[model samples]
Target: MIPSLIRMARSRTYAEAINLLNTCQSNAATIEAIRKSGGRMNDYAIVEMNDYLRRIGYVPDDLNKLNVVHITGTKGKGSTSAFTERLLRTHMTGRIADVGLYTSPHLCAVRERIRINGEPLSEEDFARYFFEVWERLEGNTKTIYPHTPQFPIYFRLLTLLAFHTFISLGVSATVLEVGIGGTYDSTNIVPKPVITGITSLGLDHVAVLGNTIQDIARNKGGIYKAGVPALSVKQDQEEATRVLAECAEEARTSSYEVVPMIPETALGLRGAHQRINASLAVALARGFLRAQGKEGMDDALPRSFVAPLAGTKWPGRCQRVEQGKTTWLLDGAHTTESLTSCGEWAWGEGNKPGVLIFNCSGGRAGQMLLTALLEAGARTSSSELVELGKRFEAVIFCTNVTYTDGHFSSDLTSHAIDPNDLSQLATQNQLRDAWLELVPGYDPKQAHVVASIQHAVDLVRGMEGEHEVLVAGSLHLVGGVMEVASLQGSLGMV
Candidate 1:
């Protein structure tokens, strides 16, 4: 115990703890294991995380006291979760002490993934609690079992930490965004969420989640438990919708309803797709408020709910900014599905000299994303849709890595890309080649590939004349831009 205590105490700064956390990041080996097994480890992982929480002095019932709204889906889950938090915080004024939000793959800081009342935990608080959990788990590992994982995986630990933080802070409510597909996700360990939502299911994480949309929907349905209200946007895939309903029936859910898009609800988040996300949020918030005994919650989509829902601010999703001569349109859309919406939003914003600054991690479908972007842009116009694609003056692809020396920020460095790939510029070159193939006669000079994010930003920032820069594809890439371009403090992207 003394050795464990010393080890934990050695990380005297938040930066040190972040570095240590990055080491726990899952590598290619883990991803390969998930792919081979089809990521059915959801149940096993929940049991594992549950045991970890117990070892750290938390039980399902203990966490249950902090009423939770658990949300999971392929896309828009993060944005939906953010909307629910704001509405709950506003509607439940004086009714709840704090609203704890836990989402994944943060744009800037890992701490940004866990926020209390829309603000990240301070560096001091993060370090203090980080070691508190780390030391406790270290000392109890062998005592709990002869063989256990050295520590919880990164996402699982962060989930436990969010629960721990909320419990320690005595928060009244928590809004959880599922780390992955539903059924066996760690967040599913909760005895019962007050309400659960599936936000627009699509074909994503096909290898780990499932091969088909129905399989993906079944896994997402894992979050539904007996007696909890289940809400969702009626999916376009009939089979996926049927499977989700079957799961709800199997769990004997309190109520399973398919919500419709609310018309003319001006959203704080840009794009037409956000209306669907907002609609789900409105339903989830209404269900949550009703559970808390707040009256006047009905199908009308309350007049009071309008203000708070519109006030919600989630960055890196159709977000816009003006940095001097450059206009930055940022959206963390990596999957083909979301990138379709992203491209539509970006192209609709302007038909000017634009440069697409893009990169994707985690084996994302880069070519499919690029194709989707062009297709979406073409769809937005009838007369000269081809002309819209030509409006993009340049296409920039680069690694999400911040520095050329192969060092990543303490919080952001956990990548699965092999060192060989970086040296060969495999990802960027693939993107560049894909762009060239998509555009016949496109000047190869118009497509630029840089070794690091800073270099990409420097090149574009130095470009003469007015420019529209679309930083799309991955949140990591958008986040790297924030760090290199000094947008974190200047724009408060965090």
Candidate 2:
């Protein structure tokens, strides 16, 4: 494997890196493993990830040296991670040299998942590090981790590459967001993040996770390492709070503090829920700074933290993008709770007529998300005005398949959808039906479906007059539309 790395290092261009990646990527195998087990989180993912890391000459301890700020939750993980990274960079840029950010589900490019100093790795650097890790594992999969997978799955590989890049670049601080629920998550292989945090937890990923909020909280709390400062947002329910405390004790961390959400906190991101996320970010930043042995890193958020927290900009989360004929209120809120907030944020403040551009990944929660959005917009009583439902005249559901050719961008190609869903338009149709039920008298003609993102953009482009289009439900959908609509290269929307 070492020899393979040396050989690939000779001339592994970006194209070859992508080819190797496509050949190696496989979610079907994991899905099959889950199906065989009747669908539960098992040792398979944990063993594969840790074994693969060991093959590439990395261990959990090595990752700990990167000074990680690990985070997980049902929502706001990315925004909290973003704020943590930006805030750390504010004080640690010159001190730390480089701050590595490892996140998941990139908007457009896989490079977006592995970043340093606020920018995604360059094509040349990404390909270099990508193949360096790939070939090393490829060479050893047959022998070193003989019983384990020869190549790590997509996210696992990126996780390895992120650690490699950060270490190789001499990074002093790292921000890590869990790819899934924390207990068996690929990123959880890191044993000792300097500070671990759980943002808001909710009933998301219920099939793999358990059926209840307490179940989800325990799973997310798995990132806590003993003797580390474990922080979390204050849970709304007593059971959730109890489960979090139990998990904290189970993990036996040095201390646990549930940071309270500040009321009316100014945040760069839209949506009211961001105030809590911002508060968590503030706590994480303080913990990270204190870990560096920096003086004045006391309990309070430094006066400097406010500007970055309030001014932080995380792309595509409740962002507003205007192009040509429409104003896009873009958010990647897929869960019921977040989507409810998105609906209120979209309709509660504005009076202009809206057109909803919505799609969720194939999940059981699709109907629930749609219901939450509609309820958010609907009036609870006769005297109360109906403001939410009246904002949108059109609701479009489209597959996140980016191109008219029915192919996705290289980075996005790994999002597995059942072939039947693609052929039958199963999920999109499900959303359309749900929309009809929510708005009883609205014309079925208002609910539309398109083949690809290009078709969806064209449908919006053909609309008459000014319209506020709420692009919600999936980040992939928003990113696909942005790529097709030529909004990616625009100014000041981030």
- Look at candidate 2 and give me any clashing residue pairs: 354-391, 377-388
Alpha-carbon RMSD of each model: 2.5, 3.5
1-494 per-residue lDDT for model 1 (tens digits)? 34544564576579877866776777765755554444574435666777899878778888787799999988899999989998888866564347888888887788888888877787888888888887778667653444558578787788888888888887788999997677777787888889999998766556433378877888889889899998878897888889999999999999999987776777788888888899999999888988889889975578888887778888777888778888788888888888889877877856443788988753555677788887887776442444665666778898878876767776678556666778888888998888887776778888999888888888887789988888988888898888777677532222
All candidates: TM-score: 0.94, 0.90
For model 2, what is the alpha-carbon lDDT of residue 192? 81
**lDDT of candidate 1 vs native?**
0.79
Instruction: Please report the TM-score between candidate 1 and the true structure.
Output: 0.94
**Error of model 2, residue 388, in angstroms:** 4.3
Clashing pairs in 1: 42-184, 183-222
How well does candidate 2 match the true structure in TM-score terms? 0.90
Best by TM-score: 1
* Residue range 161-220, candidate 2, lDDT tens digits: 888899888898999999777888888878888899999876555553345776677778
